[model samples]
Target chain A: MNDKVAQTVKTKGITRRFLIIFSVAFCLLLASASTHYFIVERSERIERETRELLNIRLGKAAIERDMQDVISDLTFLARHNETSGIFLPDNLDARQALAQQFRVFSEQKGRYHQIRVLDETGQEIVRVNYNNGEPIATSETLLQNKSDRYYFTETWATEGRNTYISPFDLNIEHGEIEIPEVPMVRFGTLMFDENGNKRGVLLLNYLGSTVIEDFREATANIADHAMLLNSDGYWLSNVEKDREWGFMFGRNDTLAEHFPDAWQRINARDTGQFSNRDGLFSFTTVYPISSSQGNLGDGLGSLPADTSYYWKAVSHLPPQSFSASLGEFLRRNMPLYSTMFIFLAASSFIVALTRFHHRQAVSEVETERSFRELLERRVDERTDELKTAQVEKDLVVQHLIQAEKMTAIGTMASGIGHEINNPLYAILGLAEAIRDDDSREQARGHAGKILSYTKDIAAIVRNLTGYARPFSGTEHKPIDINEVIHKAVSMVKRSLYDDRIEFRTDLGGLPGFSAHSEEIHQVFFNIIRNGVQSIEDDGSLMITSRYDGEKIVINVKDDGKGIAPEDHSKVFDPFFTTKDPDQGEGMGLYVVHQIIQKYKGSISLESVVGKGTTCVIEFPILPSVKKGNP
Target chain B: MMKQKILVVDDEESVRETIRLQLKSTGHEIIEAEDGKQAILLLGQSNSHGVSVIICDVRMPNINGIEAVSFFRRDHPSIPVIVLTGYPDIKLAAEFVEKGIFDYVVKPVEKERLIAKVEKAAIQSAVMNIVD
Candidate 1:
């Protein structure tokens, strides 16, 4: 359960890291893609505006070229000698010949509305009209006498062989505006007589609609955006045809009114391009007559440079057309961008997954390592506990051995008291006798007895003290096993005698071994005491000790009330005893067994109920202790 | 006021000899027995009938003072038994007193005190003889 929670936390951490990495990567892709998109969009806008400017430039060039052509044609007619022939005294058919020549010129050009020759007084001498693709001669009576027209007067007034061009406007045949607006430009040049005297002017009413049509053709691709505006800011040709020639139609609508800011900038330059929020504007000025002056025939010096007369060819692109349309932009680049996006997403996901897996692997290894460490620590702790338990067990065993020794001393207390008291009694009695005796001889004998009795008490006390010594160290010393057995027997001999139980020791000569004499004594003491206690009455106990080269063996046999077969196994166990509770604590044999085992000895018992019991004990002679032993 | 014949029962010969020496001035006959068993065997003899008091030591081999005293009380009720032992145990003294023994004495007893106890036990033995 804890592992599941930890796993969830780890997964969440990895997911958070993955999200961070993927989001950064995705944001980077978006940044670069948008940068590329904007760069492309800006570049496309520049390219489109440049093309528009080029279109207007080309339109302006075309209009200037056509105006030059018209001036050249007028110069050609004016410089011809046909008019000079009409002024000759004997040349009567020169006027008729010039009229026919002009009719033929008008018929072939089809762009001319009328071709006429007027005298210097501004009276028309001859005229030819292009009647909508047909040529006709105007009779003498129909020709106007004095011309108030600017093209005719201006040509006659100019010095040298210069030309005159009138402002483009609608043509009026008789002092009324033409119904079907014939937008016109008049080109005129003065004619010279044979003597180099100017006699009349050659006037051609050029159709203005042809120039507008040429503009439309030149900018046909952007015909809707293309515009032709006169210097007065009136439209000559516009996408809305009704807006054209607004000055002539007396309409206030014009480029200046509709786009004042654009017109201000457009009219300030001869050629430029600019944009506003509404749209892109590209325009160039066309100076027709002044530009055409240099291209006239040799004899025609041309007109004065008219800087004021110019037409602006403007190309406007509305915001929708000028800027990129979102739908179109997506149509063109959706595949690439979407593919790039998908690739970015896939790669980022893969990278994130790889990173997540790497982290998981690292974390798993860390977890495994930590778990192993935890297990090792637990093992170390368990080992420490076991070691502590072992030490505690050693302490407890020592305590138990001491406690058993104390119990053994307690069990011998009565016997030891009797043993001590018997001698005490003897000494007391002998002293009393010596004090009461009258004869020196009897007193001496009693004194000797008292000394002997004191000596006996001392010897008994010595044995009791030796057996009852508290357990101290574990240091071993070479000891006679027989002597240890004697001392152990002495501890309980008095008790056994009182109980009418006889004990005998058949000790053979034995090699010495290193051992604690106290421990050895306790072993025999416990066994002997147990044997003595088991006998109800008149029991005999015999102990035998011998060394058989490699080992020391001792056997204790008793003709007492024997232990039952079932109890024989448990007799050596702690707290297992047949003695009454006050007589024993049941630890005697158990302590003996423990001490024997500690010295690498073995003990075994054989018993039969109501018959006898025998206990045999054996200890291997250690090499270290057997050295120098006889 | 005839000289009393006292039976001294103990495992140690010195104690019996000392009691004999202590009673010499009083002129009591100091008969000696090693233990309760020896004392019983001596009493069984025809020549040992004049024993008026028995001083027996407890914790002896074969027959202890308690068992011999019980036997004496049963078989020779006129004979007073004094318990003499080295162990000064109140419980054992109380048990012997309840058993109608004449007196209980711990060993290493003072000479005067023992003589006094022995004289008292002899008087009790005379009284018991008269009652029997």
Candidate 2:
């Protein structure tokens, strides 16, 4: 049964230790993996947002460049000498030359729907049409009057050389929406004669699709999510063609209708980028006729440059596009993270199992060995019981020593009583003198004596009570042996005088140690009192204390009757005293021996018969005691 | 009656001083000693220095009151000696009384009792002198 118990005892604790180690290892792995995963996810999101912003910036630049190109073409044609000559009456050759110039421009650019020159009356003198990438010049008979056209009338009304950029809209022909759905912007500039007189208007019908196509090309990477919207929040270019030109179709497919929150932000900003629950939106305002380019009037145009004509180029990334997918992130990293975790778990398990098996084997061997020694162990237990009894006996002896201490205090009561009474007697006599001696000066002197005597009595009582109380619970405080010796002297000094034994001390600077002051006092009290009693007549009992580098050495020498060498060994024995039976109980030196041994100190007596005796005691300074004067 | 001298012997200076103060107005000359040794030394002077009564404490350094009293009983047997002790043991008091000491007074003695004892001891000494 004992063998079984021993074998399993260590395994239970071993398993629990392994479990604690495994739990800690798993928690650490989890923490590191979570940190790595979040870092990867955040960085991916930032990279995607950066790419989308760049796309929006480049698309806006492309759209603005295209609009500037159309303006440049219109200015070039209007500045041509042939355009001035064509405005003169009966200048057919000039008209044909200007028509040929416009045809070549339309054919080369392939972005003009029509290029026309209209007189002040708004009649076209020369017109060129871009017939599906083919440029054709119309004869004077086929050229129609465009006086009712807003582009011709608006351009002719300009005072000086100025370009007029019209808003983007679908083309209307003969008061009906044009077929094939052409998106147009008419750029017109008034033509001037050689004398700087207003002559006619040069108009260009620009193909708006080219600008949209250029925007798409510039943002091809994010084209599917890119959008171009007019200032009115109408989409000019959308992924769904049906959603584009909602203003023309009277459809509620505008950006404002689709994404009101994104439109609100994009409408208010000229350029910015932000992210929300709808994901990343990077946008910029593309001014088709920016202040610098739209006013070509050279300080003579009626219309100032328009700041309101703008398109919003936006690159959007939906939540799905920009948000790092947890599944994908997990797929990329889970295998490694899990493998690391499992590898550690398995390694720890193997280590734990190996140790567990090794311990179990050792435990079995231990169990067998213990079984073989069972009889010896029983004998050991019996010996242990004897030792326990010995300890109990030592405890009883300690109690007896305490009782003996009380008895010693009882013997000390007479000396202490004398100590207190001497001062008390002085106080009583002085008080009586103060009452009877009517002299004021004499009364003052007596009162002073009474005060001092009362103080002396208080001191004596304090010392007596302190010495009488047995040390309880063995609580030790740092004590200076010199101070304790002084206290011990105070308790028995009065009695020493009675025996005419002069008590003298040469206490040196010794290090302090932790001990019950009462215990140390009792030790010294017994030693000194023994020396005093040994004196049959007037003699000097001198105590010299000094620290000899490593130990405290105290020598108590008495010029009294000494001890015989033959009985030196038995002097420390309990109930061993040379005094009469009535004089002492004889446990004094024995208790002193016990206390000295408890402090790891040693005491020895050196004496010769008829000569004085010297008690030399040495206490080793414990490592914990602070060195220096008490 | 000639002016008599009173000797007070005690280990404590305060006790000797108090006794001196108590006997100040009595017209008897006062002498003080710190201990029994000093008292015996002073009394060992010529003709015992006319000290009529000795007030001595039992506990004293060098020679105690008891030993001093024994010396006086053998040498200056006419001078009266009073033993004042803090330890008031009946056996010790009886022993001193048998040893022919004039009085045994415990410490913290009443003022009247101590003064009466000293006066009575002083009168006994003067009567002995007159008888001589």
Candidate 3:
């Protein structure tokens, strides 16, 4: 009982060990794998951010170089002696020389599209137009603007002589795109004599196409979405051409307008990059904005405050830029991945094995239970079979007893009939003889013979009726052994006589026994009748009774054809017979043996083939106890 | 019919004597034997009287009526046998009669019926056209 329990606990211990090992291995693999993923992700992110920031600064520097070139060209024009000679009291020769000098300056330096000199009244003092490939100074008649132009008014409003750079846009002539769509910006600065005079503004129109074109060329080789937006988040240049310069065209579709959430983070941080599921966006305020470009002060120095009015450059890298392949990471850490996989697989296999064994154990238990039930059912069936067999055996025994009684009666019936029949015949024949006899002597003699034959029939009838009647005597009585033998012989003598056999009874001095006399008589009768039937003809039966020591011995012997050796063993068995079915029921010796046994007597036979048979019964002088009628 | 000769066979002496006495009043001759074997032997003798009819009992120690009749059938084909029995075993009696026995009579027999049966058997024997 406890053995199975202990085995189950042992099995549980082995499985639990595997379970704990699998759980710890699985958790450790998961933690390490995730940690490696985060580290790789963060490193890739920082590398990509630094590359984007460098590209943004590159784009801003291009724009600033174009602005510095315009300012240097304007300052060189202002310091020329031909331009200051105008303040030396109008010498015609000096004025003509200045015109010639301006023409030559435009021919030599062709980056400027237009150059002019204006006084405080916004008059063009001297102008030169670079037409085609050469510059030509305009006559005095073509210097038309007095003061309405913004570059002229914005410069004259400055308290000190200071330089101003105009916003970059597509050049428009009379509210229409200029021929060939020239992108331009105007540079204006106040001009004054050596000490303190407030002179007019000198301005130049610079070509802005080179800077925007350079930004586009730099971004063309890379897959990153690069855009350049100004201080107000207006797109200056975008990889998508439609998004650029929207604020300049009054559309104002800026980066802040499209992605407000990203703009909030971008507005708070400078020179930073972040990643989201959609894409990678890196931005930098390369030239930081200080105050609004609409306001200006007296200071004209190139201070930090002056440089603050500048544009921002932004680059959009797509989602692929931020995440490196986890596959590549796994390839580098092949042993680690393989270990985790093997652990998981082994755990799964163990779990499956445990489940299979659990099912097997359950099925085995069920099989045992079913087998026990079957055994119980078989035991019940066997018990029932035994009971039924016992009942059948009881019925067989009952039938055997009834058959034995009928057999005894049948064996005696024919002999009894012959006994009665012979006498009847003698009586009928003698009665006729008597009636016909006239002499008294002869008639009297026939009548006497008839009376004796009648007596013979009466004796036979008495014996038959006595035997047929249900016996009421069961008590043991003191019986003369010789008397019982004589009575037994009387019943069977007629049949013996009919067969031409002689039955002689010799009665010796025999003591009486306490027994059922009729039963003992039956035993004698059975042997004598059997003796008579065994003879074919001229046989003799002899019955003798005597006392020997403590036993009373009765012998009935037949001088007839003897029982065969093969049949001797079965002669006393019930239903064993050599006689015809009509003649006997064949239970004679078996019943005789049983009756002798009831008195505690034993009967034995001795015989020789073709000689004779002898049946000897020896019973005690007294029975141990009286038996009821069977 | 030449005054028919009758043979009576019985195992018992009293029955034979009674049958002899019974046939004495008749003018016909009577012959007797103790059993069927003696009756058959008497018929087989050269000096034996001509037995036209035989009355024999079935229950006898040696050569009972059935054997005597069945044996005499081939030897004395002209003679007819009548079966008489003390026990009324009609099936056996009838079986013998079917094999050309003259008649069957049960014992404790009526004398009148016995005499009539004997006369009929005598006449039957005389008239039988058996080749012998």
Per-residue lDDT of candidate 2, residues A226-272 (tens digit): 99888888888888888878888788777778778988998888888
Candidate 2 regions off by >4 Å? Answer: A1-391, A438-444, A498-506, A548-550, A626-629, B1-3, B24-26, B44-49
Q: Who wins the DockQ comparison?
A: 2
**Model 3: CA > 4 A from native:** A1-148, A152-163, A172-176, A188-204, A221-302, A306-379, A382-386, A393-630, B1-39, B46-64, B70-90, B93-132
What is the two-chain DockQ of model 1?
0.33
Compared with the true structure, model 2 gives a TM-score of 0.48
Top model by TM-score, which number? 1
> What pairs collide in candidate 1?
A122-A147
Model 3, B7-77: lDDT tens per residue?
Answer: 77887777777677667666678878887678778987864557888888776766766777787776777
True contacts kept of 1: 0.50
Candidate 1's residue-wise lDDT over A604-628, tens digit each?
Answer: 9999888788899998998777764
Among the numbered candidates, top lDDT falls to 1
TM-score of 3: 0.45
Q: Tens-digit lDDT track for model 3 on A1-630? A: 899996886577656666776677778777888898778766866666776777766765666555555566666676554246664546656655766777777777666677887766777877788785578888877777759878788777755544666766677878786867677767777778766676667777776666677665655544247777766787777767777677657887987787777776777776777766557777776442133221223244543446545666678876664444566677777787787679686975586567656766887799989999998999899889988996786466434544654566665554565556666767776777777767889888888888888887887788766754543546777777687777777767644324467778787776557776766777777788788878876878888877766787778889889999889989889878888786577777877777777678899998888999998889875444223222
TM-score, per-candidate, Cα-based: 0.63, 0.48, 0.45
